[model samples]
Target: MESSSSSYLNLFVQETAFYNRIVLGTLLPDIAWNPLPHFFQTWLRNYIGGTLLYFLSASLWCLYIYQIKRSVYVPKDSIPSNKAMLTQIHFAVKGMPWYTLLPTVTEYVIENGFTKCYSTINDVGWIPYFVYSAIYLVLVEFGIYWMHRLLHDIKPLYKHLHAFHHMYNKQNTLSPFAGLAFHPVDGVLGATPHAMALFVVPMHFRTHIALFFVEAIWTTNIHDCIHGKIWPVMGAGYHSVHHTTYRHNYGHYTVWMDWMFGTLRHPIDDDESKKEF
Candidate 1:
């Protein structure tokens, strides 16, 4: 931690860099692959470091959401049963070799002991930061929205790639494991935006790191049937519909896509939820 207080951006960057270094200097790994510089110099170092970042970041959110499930944010049984959660984790572990592509294929850099990250604010200006952030939010959501919808629209693809996740059918039966327990292809598709963004735009490395955490949390939350006033944004409630009905609400981050495509829908209710997984 910094001895002196710093801005949020500085703090996030510091935290991200610290975690990257932890994995880099240690033995943890996904696969050896690298095309960056400095601390991200070696293939093994980058593999271990990036995968470590994904695991730790995802685990932290799982812990936070676990608390919420037991407390105010949700009912005690909001997520899958402990045994079921463990099973999902096990299967997810089995798929690690494939899912490892997400981090291993992505890139990172560092300079002067600091992780190499471009901040729109530092590189350009505040206005450009706003513009880029807005653009990113729209495009990423749009991409995921179509991608999800297409998976459902295509039958063979769903059976082979997307069907496993649907097994955890209940809205409350989703945990962080459920968030990532995707078939390797599914996981890569979901993660494509991350790799694409690094080259497509000028973004702070901190923001790049933040996006992973956001994806993890949102993925878990959207599966738990937690609805909100922001109907445009696909939260827990929206995605819950997709799982149960096996149709509708195919958008990723927002209902706006669903709305625009005439797929927006209200989440299933207690009566509908009881209709068996």
Candidate 2:
């Protein structure tokens, strides 16, 4: 009788475990809640932080640009007020979309079946969050670096599609989204490729969040023109050169690719070969 009791107890425990897995799986894929709440909290914090940083950095850059404009382009007799200059900067940056539909579409694609190879990364046991993030970052960066280089190659395409961004002929924090004002072909080719990389690479939620922040900060930094001698050390000045000349400096996140392919240059050099225009 005691032996019979032991068998029945073991069977009951196994059945309970099986039932619990079914319940949890039905509710959440990883037995975890959707992180939309957490994502919003983090996004709000970053948005606030980014706004503060952009204000200070952009102000300094605007003042620098104004000084350059006054010396080279503006009449010596008319000194623009700081308020007037700042208004221009504010309008330029604010007019562009801060949050975009491309990212939302990319996320929806990932949640659906656009690219499913990355799903296995979530199942890898013993992998830490940071490791997964690092992998995704490397993959996305590699993809973007190549795609940006490709965009600058075809002349007819570049002029018609990407000409609006070069319209600035100078750098500002507002320049990244400034491209949004471009032809629809430019928008689709320039932004969508990198946005879609997320769907191609299996990324964890943490990695996706990190990528968003990194891309935003880097994009703003590349367009800010106040880097001076400190810019090259931080990899910020090349894009400014690209703006001024309109032909070189195509890599989005890093200069290494540009350097390797003979596209990198100093901001003031008149070397037309280095210029992408």
Every model's TM-score: 0.69, 0.55
Name the weakest run of 10 consecutive residues (lDDT summed) in model 2.
Answer: 171-180
lDDT of 2 by residue, 1-277 (tens): 9776455344433432343345434544642533334333223334344455455655554455456554653343434344444544454345333443444445445434455324333455446545655666556656665666666676777676566545556433233333223454554455554566555555553346446545555655565443434432424466777766656677676555566666677665647424533
Best by lDDT: 1
Q: What TM-score, to 2 decimals, does candidate 2 have?
A: 0.55
- Candidate 1 per-residue lDDT over residues 106-197, each given as its tens digit: 53332222333454467767787767667766777777877787777799989998888787888467665676677778877876766565
Per-candidate Cα lDDT values, in order, are 0.62, 0.50
Which candidate wins on TM-score?
Answer: 1
Backbone collision tally, model 2: 5
Report residue 62 deviation for candidate 2 (angstroms). 4.9
